[model samples]
Structure formats: structure tokens, C-alpha cells
Target: MLENLKKEFLQPLEEFTPIPFWFWNDYLTEEELDRQMLAFKEKGVDGFVIHPRLGLPEEIGYLTDTYFHYVRYAVKRASQLHMKVVLYDEAMYPSGSCHGQVVRENPAFASRGLRMSARESAEEGELLIAAVKREGKTWYFWEGPSGGTIRGVHYGEDDGEAGAPASADLMNPEAVALFLQLTHERYYQELKEYFGNTIIGIFTDEPNILGRCSKEGMIAWSGNFLEDFYRQGGNEQDLYLLFADTDSSEGRRAGERYKRAVYERMSRAYYRQIADWCAAHGVAMTGHPEKSTDIGYLQHFTIPCQDIVWRYVAPEEEKAITGEHSTMGKCSSDSARHRGKRRNGNECFGCCGAPEDPYRFTMEDMKWYLDWLFVRGVNMIFPHAFYYSLRDRRKEERPPEVGMHSSFWEDYHIASDYIKRMCGLLTDSVNQAKAAVLCRSEKLSWEIAKPLFENQIEFNYLEEELLPSCRIENGCVLIRQQRYPVVITDGKDTPETRDFLRRLEESGGTVLVWNAALTAQKIREAVKPAETFLPPARDLRCTCLRKEGTEFLFLVNEGENSVTTNLRLEDGHICQIWDAWNGTIKQLELPVQEMKLSLGQRESLILVTDRGE
Candidate 1:
């Protein structure tokens, strides 16, 4: 079994290839498209996302017949090459506007938001959000919609802001339906034959409620948001609390209710609608939401996804381990695991270099980002881009293009093969985690996560929404074949979540409230990990997985410095070191109770052992 697994891991399937976003950013000719496709295929990358980006001349308008002609040619060529294609469902990012066609056709569908003012001035056709008197001052909240600004995709002179295009109201189901009619339906019409075969899925980039460039202090709203909120048991008085930052219990609860309502409405209006369309058409809906911790919306995705862009995480940065974005890798992966999905994806390495030195992106930095995602259980990778043309200003749209125009394009196969092997290994394996950290749909406990990573504790983030459906079995929380003997919490739980935790505790499960008093030693006592480190390497991260009858321990040095430690395992197990980078395996001597392990900065290693009977 080990030998067979080794053989399989060495030569991964094409499905595991890094499907980079092929930015169609210039006057694309069939000859140039075929040449770039051939180059990618030669470099071991068997798939690409046809991302329509900036720099295309007005002659080739978005979603025009000419655009479809080129897209059809690329899809046909991909089929001939036996390569997969994922259609990006937008001209440029923040999808759902159909490149402003949705709002252009119906100006009423433009993005809307709620604004509060002390003076009441009723404008014609303006929708009133709320009316509340706080501290004897009457506050009038009304819709303040804004969009349809024709700022093309380029870096703004002021603070390098990438101006957003006209965005439709994603909170409105009618607007979303129009978007699908213009974008997704057109793709299905053009490439109906390749729905589930050559063309695997459609990518919907982040679609927010109000979208980018919305007015400050305005909450995302739609024409019928108040009606839906009322239908969902929301009070009109609570609407005022959303505009204020008061810490009163009533205000806090009201804020949570409003945000929850917004998330639910957007999920039903936008994500669910798109997901159903894809499912009916035999394609998968794959994309991330606006926020990283928006796991509530991710449940609707066939291929749950999140993105790491603009240096949200880096090699030696604390952001990599202790930020809201850091949880995104696990956010998608855990959502997939709970939903019984095979793969989760991340769109990574976009604008990851320093702003002062955008071209300073290195192969080592790429490797670190890859390991960060793979170790967290993400199996599919969408490399930020492979630009078709880097002519003129197109090169600066999103800096540090890691594809055909990169400094390492000659040896691109090296990175491609590494991606394939790591993705292949993580795809079908069962994550062997004995603990779960409870989190809300929009909130993750980074305070708890930081300590857990430092202590080498392997766990998954379990959303509170999923707790009721989970079965409590013999002092363990079981759901979708994942069992957790211990559940950790950051102590900021909602009433419903607290009730669920109480039930779990009553069922013989260990509930650890994350606080300053709760140390790593206490966590070790509760989880009692299968493997232990001699001196507890703080910056070393590990994920344990099982495939066939073998166990694999993937370890990464997330810190800038080197780490040396002795790993101790059970006496009956046999260990081997599998090098994913070079596809090599080294057997260990018998009686391997304890072995010394050393890893350099941003380096990773895999320890394979037998599942002893």
C-alpha cells in the first residue's frame, strides 16, 4: 500500500494541476492564446481560468460576440489539449454587475445602502430605512444608493485605490437574477456542450451587498431589505443601533441581528441563486465572498473558496498566524469537510509583494504561500494570474504577475509539480483532528487560534450553525465522519451557542473556554495529541491526515527562524520521511520511538507512518 501510494503521489493526475487565472488583458488573437496555452501545458499546468481583466480595447467589448468567439476558441482548444477550464464570470473583479450591464439595463438595480441623518428631508423616490429618536434627537435613516461611476480598472492616483465599476445590488434577488441572465446564462449558451466535461465550473468573484466605493457609514441595503428583515423577525428600532457603535447589550444584540439578516438575505439572493443555476446546468459554483470569515455564505459554494491577496499574509509576518484572513484557509477547507465536499480552493499570491517593491516576489515566497494553504487542508490553488499580455500599463493593474511574465517562467514546472503533489495528497485524505474550535458564521476566534498553532494542536473550526446537526457520541462531537473529543471556545458565544456547548458538555465532551488562564499545557492535556514535540516548537505548524491505512504528518516552519525538535510517536508505528518538493521518500530505522526533526525558515516536511493494528 505504501509503495502504491508513493507511486500515485509521484505522478499526480491533471486534476491536481494549479489552475491559474489566465488574464485576457490585451488584444487576444487565437495564435497568441494557443501559444500561451501550449506554454502552460508544457510547464505541467493543465488547467486555467479565463479571467477577463483590464487592458482589452473597446473593439472587444465585454460579453460581446467577439469576446465569446475568442472564449469559444479557448474552450475548444482546452478540450483538445485535455485540459480543464474554469470560466470567470465577470469582466473584472467584484463580480455580479455583468460589467455594469445589470445596472445599465435597469438603473433601479444599482447598489443601495442605508444612511442616517438628524434632519429629515424626504427626497422623491427615496426609500426610508428607519426612524428612531435617540437622546431626544430624531434620527432619520434612508437609502443612499451610489454606483455607475465609469472608473476603469486602473490604480487611482490617490493612495493607489483600484476604482470599482458600477455594482448591482447583490442583496436584491431580482438584480442577481438579471446578473445571471446576462453573465452565467450567456456562458452556458456559448459552451453548453462542455458544461461538466472540459469546462468544470464558473468562478464568481467576491460580490458584496453595497460593493466597493460605497459611502462611509452606510449599511448594505436593498429596496426590499426592510420587508425581508421584518419577515425574519427583525425590529425596526434595532436598525438605528446598526448606525451607532454603542456597547450596550441591547445595541450589541441588535447589531448582530442586523448583520445576520444581511448575510442570510445575501446568501439567498446571490449565492444560492448562482449555486442553483450552476447545479442545474451541471457546473460547480466556485468563488469566495467579500469577507474571509464569511463561512455562512461559503456553505452555498460547491467548491468552497477564499483568497489571500495584497500581502494579507507573508513569510515572517504576524498576520499569517493571527488575523481574520488567516482563518480563511481553514474556513473553506472545514466548510468542505463538514459538507462532504472533496476539494476546497484558495485564490492566492495576488499583489503579495511589498507595495514599494512590487516585483520583489520570489519563488521562495510562492512556496511559503502554497504550503500555508496546503497545510491548512486547501486542495485547489488558483495562482493569482498568468497575464496573456503585459504591454504598457497592463503590467501594473495587479503587480507581481507570477505566471508567463514572471522571472521563473523557464522553471515553472518546478512549482507546478510541487503544487500537484501537495494538492493530490490533501484531496482524498481524512483530516485526523481530535479537537474543534467553535466559531460563529462571520466571526472566528483568532485569539484561540494563535495559541493552538503555537502549541501544535490540530483542530478544525466548527461553525455554531452546524452544531445542532452534529451527533454527540461517547464524549465526542461527530459530524460528517469527523469526531472531536474536545471543543474549544473563545467565551464570546451567543446564547444559542452557549446552549449547544452546554449540551455538549453534558454529553461527556470536554469544553475548554479560551482565556488567559487556559494555557497550551491545558490544551495538550485535553487534546492529548497522537504525536508530541519535545520542546514544543511555537512557530512550527502541523496537520495530521490519514489515507488508506497510513498516517501522514505535514509540518511547516511558519516562523523566520529554524526549528529543531524531537518528535515522539507510539512504539509500534514505523516512520518515513516523504519529500513533496522532490518526490522522494526515505525510510527510517526500526524502533523509531523518537526522532529528531529540523526545519528551516518557511520549509515543510511530511512524516508518513503505518496505522498499526
Candidate 2:
């Protein structure tokens, strides 16, 4: 198994190549496209997502014959280059608008939201969604009958910036179906021959039901949301409670119910429908949703993904280890793991540089992000983008192009080779984790995760909803092909989850509730660390995986300081170090129980071992 791994590592397949989003932000010509693609090929990039961006010429027109002609040419060129293509579903995103065509063609399909207004001062055209009397005052919630209620005021006209493309109502299945007709179906009609072949999948950028620029207090809503909410056992009165600013238990419960209903409806109406379409067409539904913690919607993606753009995470920063976006890497990877999917992706490195100097993105910054994702079990790489043109204001649209025109373009193959090699190793291996951290669809317990990471206690985020289907065995929770000896939570447990934990604890499995006093010592006592480090290196992160009886341990120094530690390996294990950057394997002759290890700041190492030395 070790020999096979070494061979595969040395010659990682093209499928593992970093697939960048190729921004077609200009009046593209076939000759220029061919030249740029050849340049990418030379740098070990074998795949690209053809992303149409802000500067695309109006004459070409999104989803028009002129656009199809260019898309077809690119797909054909990729095929000739023995490369792969991922079709970007939107002309610009958040994806569902199809470049504003959906809302423009059917104004009723425009994004909607609920707003609270005084009964006497309500606008003339306002359709009352619901009415509730509280404190001797009658509150009117208006935005048509189906609009969902939430607390906030200040509805913006479009999804993103003021002039950004209008977004479609994702909670409405009819609108989503129309979006597919205008986008996905149109692509299929033009490129049917490339589906599942040269064209591997469709990339749906973050889709939000309420336009990003919607009124400040507006909650995502659609025509059928009320009916769906009712069908899901939600009370009509609770809708009013959702808009209440009270910290009462009823208000909290109402908010939770409303959010869950919205998530479920949108997941069914949008993501699942797209997944089904991709399945039938022999392709994959890739890309992410609006929020990083939207794990529930990830189940519908064939190559479940999350984005790490906009400086959400940076090297040596607290943001890298805590917060909601920090959980994104595991959000996609763990979802794919539990679902039996072999690969998961991250659309990384967009605007990750310092805000003051956005163009200062460097090779070091790029490698840091790659290591961060790879160590988290992510196997697919979608480098934020390679630009088709940087002419005029195109370069300013999303500053700091990471490919083709970057300072490191001449030496890019080094990063490309590193990406392919790491992705190759992570792809088919089974993650060896002993603990599961319980999380919700839209929430993750990053506080619990922080101590675990610092302690080298590898864990996967287990969605609380999946608890009932998991099997509790002899001191272990079994789900699909993975097993966890202990489960931890943030103390925010539902009745069902509480009952499940009770059953698990009764079966000799460990269960922990996260709190202010929870420490690394406490976690180490409850869960066995995947790899033990002498002197306890807090900045050293480790991910262990098993591939055909051999353990592959990827260790990353995510901090600024160098880490010197001794690894305690099991007896009878034969150890070897694989340098991913240079594709070199070296045998290490060490004591059966211990091996010396040293990692520089921001450096990573891979240790492959098998029993019976």
C-alpha cells in the first residue's frame, strides 16, 4: 500500500489538477482563449470553471447563441488539451438570476421578503401576510401572503450592491425551475456531448432567496413558504414571534423553527432539484451556498464545496481557527465523507490579501491557503480564478488576480504540482477520526473545535439531524464507513439530540458538552488524539487517514512559530516521510514508539506508515 501510494504521489493524475475559475471578463476571442488555456496547461492546471464576470460584452449576451459559441469553443479546446471543464451556472452570481433574466422575464418571480409595518401607516400596495396582537397593539406583517417574517428594516433593491444583478426567489420552486430552463438546460442543449466527459459539472455560485441588498430586516420568502411552514408543523402565531425582539423562550423557538423551515424549503426547491438534474445528465452539481455553515444544503451537491474568499480566513490569525467561516473546510469535506462522496472542494484565495494592498497576493499566501484546506480533508482545489483579461477596469472588479498575470505565474507549476499531489493523497483515503462534534445545519461549534485542533484531536462535524440514522455500537457511533468513539456538542441540544446522547452515553460512548471551562486537557481525557505530540505543540495541526492499511498523517504548522515535537507512533509501524512539494519519499529509521519531527513556520509534512516493520 505504501509503495502504491508513493507511485501515485509521484505521478498524480490530471483529475487532481487545480481547477481554477477562468474569468471570461472581456470580449473573448478564440485565439486568445486558446493561448491562455495553453499557458494554464503548461503550468499543470488541467481544468477550469468558465466563469462569466462583470465586464462581459453586452453584445455577446449571457445564455445567447454568441455566448454558447464561445463556451462551446472553450469546451472543445479543453477536450483537445486532455483537460476538464466545470460550467459556471451564472453570468455573474449569486447564481439563480441567470444574469437577471429570471426576474426580468417574470417580474412576479422577483425576490420577496416580509416587512413589519404599523397597521395605520402601512403602504397602500402592501399585502398583509399576517396580523398579530401583542401588548394591546396590532402589528401588521406585509409583503404578500407567502412572505416569511423576520426582524429588521431596510430592504435593498438588488441582491448585492445597488446596481448588482437582481436575484431570483430561490425558495420558490417555480422560479428555480425557470432559472434552470434559462441556464442549466440551455447549457445542456448546447453542450450535451460534453456532459460528464470534458464538462465534469456545473458550478452554482452562492444563491440567496432574498437579494443580498434586500431591505435590512427582510427575511427570505417565496409564494409557497407559508404553506410549507404550516406543513412542517410550524404555528402561524410563531411567525409573529420570529419578528419579536424578545429574548423569551417562545421567540427563540419560533426563530429556530422559521429558519429550519426556510432552509428545508430552499434545499428542496433549489439545490436538490439541481442535483437531480445533474444526476440525470451524468454530471455533478458543485459550488457552495450563501453561508459557510449551510451544511444541510451541502448534502445535495455531488462535489460538496465551500468558499474561503474575502479574507474570511488568513494565516496565523484567530479567524483561521474560530468563527463560522473557519468551519467551512470541514463543512464540505465532512459532509462528503459521511455521504460517501470521494471528493470535496474549496473555492479559495479570492481577495484573501490585505485590504489596504489587495494586489500584494504572493506565492507564500497561496501555499498557506492550500495547506490550510488540504489538512482539513478537502480533496478538490478550485483556485479562485485565472483571468481572461485584465484590461481597463476589469482588473479592479475583483482585485489581485491569482493566476496568469500574478507575480508567481512563472513558478506556478510548483504550487500546481503541490496541489495535485496533496489532493491525490487526500482523495480516496478514509479519514481516521475518533470524535464527532455535533453541529446544526446553519451553526457549528467552533469553540469546541478550537481546543480539539490545538490538542491534535482530529474530529469531523456531525450534523445533529443525522444522529437518528447513526448506529450506536460498543462505545462507538457508526455512520457509513466511519466510526466515532466520542461525541461533543456546544450544549445547545435539541430534545431529539439530547435523547440520542442519552442513548449513546448509556451504550458506553462518551458525550461532552462544550462550555467556557472546557479545555484541551478535558478534551484529551474524553477523546483519543489521532497523533500524540511530545510537549504538546498547540500550533501543529494533524489529519490522519487510512488508505489500504497504511496510515497517512498530514501535519501542518498553521502558526507563525516553528514547532519541534516528537511523534509517538504505535509499535511495529514502518514510517516514511513524503515531501509533497518535490515528490520525494525518504525512509525514517527511528525507535518503534517515537520519531523526531520539526516543522518551520507555515510548513507541512506528511508521514506515511504501515504496521509490521
The candidate maximizing lDDT is 1
1-613: candidate 2 lDDT, tens digit per residue: 6678788888877879999999888887999999999999999999999988777777777788988889999999999999999998886777787877787798777778777655645553456667777768887777632221111111221234354556677888898999999888999999999998999999988887776556666666777577777766667677777777548888887788788889888888899989999999999999999899999899999999999988888864677898888999999999998888889999998888766798789888887888889999999999977888888877876667999999999999989889999998998888889999998888887778888888899999999888888999998999988899889888788899998899889999999888878777888877766457898888888998888778878999888789999988644453688889878888877625567789997689888766453
Expressed as tens digits, the lDDT of each residue in 309-383 for candidate 1 is 988887656887888988999999999999888899999999998656987788888998999899899999999
lDDT of each: 0.85, 0.83
- Model 2 pairs whose backbones collide: 152-217, 153-217, 154-215, 154-216, 155-215, 156-214, 156-215, 159-211, 159-212, 159-213
User: In model 2, which runs have C-alpha deviations exceeding 4 angstroms?
Assistant: 121-125, 144-163, 570-574, 590-592
Model 1's TM-score against the true structure: 0.96
How high is each candidate's TM-score?
0.96, 0.95
lDDT of 2: 0.83
